[model samples]
Target: MKRSTTLISVTLIFASIFSAGSRGGDALGKDSAGSENPMRRFLIEDGDPNLSAIIKHIDNMYRSKSSTSRLKLIVTKPRNTRTLTMKTWTKGEEKVLVIIEAPPREKGTATLKIEKNLWNYLPRIDRTIRIPPSMMLASWMGSDFTNDDLVHEASFHKDYESSLVGPSEDPNGWLIELKAKPDIVGLWKKLEVIVSEDGRIPLVSRYYDRKGRLARTLYYSDVKDFDGHIIPSKLVLIPEDKKGHKTELIYEDIDFDVPVPDRTFSLSNLERKK
Candidate 1:
């Protein structure tokens, strides 16, 4: 019943994809001012097309201004179980670093940095490896998520060609599903996003595989207003094939626009830690 390292890695990679901020619906119809379509105005005024808003929505969740909760990752399967605690810090588009700590027998710590390049440091090996392109699809740390899932985070306005996918509903309000561009790289071929009509916060997303089959579903729950932005504090990921297998991520704390040390995301920093 033991899983291969590759399988474990894949699991972790996919898990991170679900757990991380990387992961999007649509509707049609008219405007209150009668000058243009109401829905279109809503989309523009809400800054849906603004890259800053989209990036801020995802990255600002881990800002350094205020103390935020540490991130805890629990990976479970029929045979293997692992838990990881991570502290993350970001500096503009130039740097991002995540320090990982795992307890018990593996007391080792590792640092991952994404700058102009990507690299990882292993305390045990005491070496830093520049991630190769071929390894992008490889599972991360014996989990289902791929390494690429972490490094190649997508932007809505740049990475996707979004359009209305019709109407949907959730606890947040009415929604519009958006489909990914056909040529976009990644596992998901399409996404169904539920945006709160009133709040303009994303509530839920349904991910479809390349085969056009429903592959996974992600729910963004527990909406909290932070710095004039409505953010989701809790996320749940459910697989289509695995009935009982589910992953949940709860943000312990979040901050925005705080100063992070410049060297915190350096590759040398990762190497020095090892």
Candidate 2:
């Protein structure tokens, strides 16, 4: 089946912290780190040097300096299943475009994010809707995904206060938790990420509601090499309140730090028919 984009911003903002809590990928191996590394640049608490490095790598999964990818989104609810393929283009923290490529109904459907704002274009409606800041974290225009690709992109280092909550020997990975800091905007009150010391892949991530209830759980596996870097190509998210409801994102292709055009991030381009 065809895949989707981080564009799951057309798109999934993710699948961000509040993305992994964005569809995800494991970006680096234990030996390396990149400049756009989120954890390294914005670490709130410095406890374990090794833990901090690992945390940075996790954010890199979504906050890649600039990236392009073919993503496949499979949303499975107890009632039905919907699948879509999206092509996404992103440039650092500035811009992103996600276009639906299949299921003719959704083809040409897209979302654009520039700076911190979001817009959605519906081919059928022939309209461009500016996703309000208050609603950006709420839902996708056409799919069940709640994280906007833009919201997902800006999340991670930008939205939360991070700390190594504590080390868990039972889980065999450092437990990293994120809470919304003052002025930071997001839907989850808390998030927990588990990264295995044995590998570069994050084993699991849990997103919590404002009241501290477990809202959802994300599982990452199928670790594979994309280019020279090692990352997980598959991410599965299950919502706690919604029984049998899940979203799965698979990375069919991804290249980080590619060239991008700034104009593509504009509202004018978003509404222009392609």
Candidate 3:
């Protein structure tokens, strides 16, 4: 189904929250000098040394068993701007449900993703539509991000080869480049990520398309301690080609590893009136 770019923004923004959490996570824990670090011990490769461990840590920074959150999404263009308020629930690696609560015209609209399948629910028409794989690259809510940008299951540690880039602007911090393996097929030919020296928080990430052109830039800011998990509370996405266009997602509240009933992800819940 074709949707307004603004509406598409809402879906993709929530996807980012579930998948990237704006790249937030617990700080790297240290053990005794001779003890092995969980983040480094298991994933460390003999050839890459600390690079692999660092990438793995950054990739799984927001890893959790389950979560629920409320957030605001703003889509801006040269001529207009729109805002959407939404709540989302997630369990494990799959099962995500997102519902729109504000912008009355679109209230009660929802999206559900279980495993590899995705569906959209339109409250106004009371119809539930399944999103085909072909539409994965289509624009979501007219935002800078596409459908796949939110739900795509590519892994940084597995699908891409990572290497450190020296001479970074942040002293003591690191700039890492991730190039998709030749055999892996997906958007983003490469990624350049700038991580803070302390806590290893991801400050900014630049995504490059297949033609080696800059596709978009994702900026993480407004670091906040949510309960105990320290993570950026805001994410701004800007497409390289879209002038005067950007999408902003501000997390208002979140509960990690909380009890989200399985029924919360069912079709009945997706179609429920809010």
Worst 10 residues of 1 by lDDT: 24-33
Which residue segments of model 3 deviate by more than 4 Å?
A: 1-49, 139-141, 170-172
Cα displacement (angstroms), candidate 3, residue 125, comes to: 1.7
Clashing pairs counted in every model: 30, 23, 9
Cα lDDT of model 1 by residue, 1-274, tens digit: 0122322232232233222322210111001112245534544455344323332243323222322235665656656556656655654443555556546433345444454354556567677665555555553443334354444555455556555543455454444444567677877777766655542456777777778898777788787654333457677666676655555665555554455677766767766754
What does candidate 3's lDDT look like per residue over 47-149, in tens digits? 2336666776666555566788998988788999888898888776667788889889988888887776777888888998877766666545445886665
Better of 1 and 3 by lDDT: 3
Per-prediction CA RMSD (Å): 7.7, 6.4, 4.9
RMSD of 2: 6.4
* Candidate 2 least-lDDT 10 residues: 14-23
TM-score for each prediction?
0.67, 0.73, 0.83
Best by lDDT: 3
